[model samples]
Target: MELRRRYHAKAQPGQRLPDDVWTTDALGVLSSGSKRDRVNAELFRAIAAYRQVVAKFKMGDMAGNALHRIGVIYTEYLKDPDKGFQAYQELLAHYPGTKEAVNALYKVGAYYLEKKQFAQAVKSYRQFVYNYPNDKRVQDGMLAVARCHMETKAYDKALDAYQSYLSKHPDGKHAAFAKAQVAWIRTYHY
Candidate 1:
């Protein structure tokens, strides 16, 4: 109740919250409160803060961050995967080529994977790889491609993806795991 009051007070119409207060308030509840209380606080406060920023600036780096945080809160704390997906999609649609968009794309792919929508997961990950080939996530995205194939029981495609990943990123972080997967597939499927 008090938190709601404070949030409303700080986020009154036509009155933007101070940057410091927004940041502090968003973080404060997480630090000292119970886990459930902290998540509830984060969800409400982050939304208010984000709305205030967008209302004031229209769009900016901080607004992008706030949008990403809302997606995370929906997914991580609220356990609302659909809302999380919506928030992430909104970020990508609005922010387009920003770093936050890249992250949102990856997260969208992950959500698809979690939902067992392998085709959509592959598409999203491929989009990320195509758009940000130089980004560190490319390796992870490639690994996810192979994982999606494996999960969908496309052993041949999974093998192909693993081989491609091995060829391209021999020293990549997932190399050991990829190698193990290859050996497992050969032993079990062949």
Candidate 2:
């Protein structure tokens, strides 16, 4: 109750809770001045309250930002790819037009690639390329799509994607790399 009061006091009238106070260090504060059991209880209560506030918000850039943060924490701090994937997936689903969506798409593709899930990586990169065709990262996404097919032993598909990218972006940042890959793929076929 006291924590809730403090949280509400800091919140602007009709505004959502500020993002800063949810930091792990601040969350640690709930343990101070309490016994082990009491501290755990208070800490969990605070976490639950914060989650409730987070849930009340609409899906968009803000949600994407939160999901990205969660993803990073899970991926880097917790060393939990499954949880991280869920966060990335949520960001992609909720904010497909936001910068976070682009990043989420890249992360999802990379995650699948690392897991050797080449088909899933190809699907993700394809979606990214289609959605953000004009983005500077489009070239990289194109390359990723080709790489996914290559990793999956689909040499023809890899060659086709790379050729398409070269046709559209002859002078792209990845152009030389794509051409090299095309030559490499041709050697396998011939």
Candidate 3:
């Protein structure tokens, strides 16, 4: 309750957020207490301020960036995966065209992957590739889908994904990894 009060008090609507707060991991260079508290205070202000920017000023990109930051803040800094995941999802829905969407997709997939939700991870990874075909990370997304299938011990799916990855990205960055994984899967699973 106190934290909620603090957040509301600091996060005044339409307040102008400072630029430095974004890069400030430690407001007082204090890791646990001041970092979290100060970062939350300033970031709450930023979130409020940017929300107004999106609503009134009609700045989609800026607001999308802000949403991405909020997701990161909740996920990494605040240790709240649920809120962080929600924030990321919000960004993807509201700002699908923004560059932040690409990274948000990756984070969302990562959240599911870290949770060992292999099916969800596969879906997210495939979505990442399907949605952002032009992105440099597209290969990473494709490889991730295979990795998710591999982790689930779906050797046939993994084999197909790895082969597809190798076909699509022969001599690409992860080619060796794909080849190695395919070899291992074939030798052991077959």
| Worst 10 contiguous positions by lDDT, candidate 2 | 31-40
Candidate 3, superposed: residue stretches over 4 Å from native: 1-36, 57-59
Of models 2 and 3, which has the larger TM-score? Answer: 3
Greater lDDT among 1 and 3 belongs to: 1
lDDT of 1 by residue, 76-154 (tens): 8888989889879988887886788888999999999999999999999989988988988899999999999998999
- Clashes in predicted model 1: 0
Alpha-carbon deviation at 25 in model 3, angstroms: 20
Residue 62 lDDT in candidate 1? 71
lDDT of 2 by residue, 75-162 (tens): 7655777878987897777767777778788889889988989889888888888887887888888888888888778899999999
True-structure RMSD for candidate 1:
7.7
Clashes of each: 0, 0, 0
Instruction: For residues 1-190, write the lDDT of model 3, one tens digit per residue.
Output: 3433454666535655586754554433333365457667666676676667667644547778877887887787778888889878988888888899899998999999889998998888898988888889888888888988978889999999999999989999999999999999999999
Sort all candidates by TM-score, best to worst. Answer: 3, 1, 2
Highest lDDT model number? 1
Cα error of candidate 2 at position 181, Å: 1.6
Candidate 3 lDDT trough over 10 residues, lowest sum: 23-32
Candidate 2 has an lDDT of 0.76
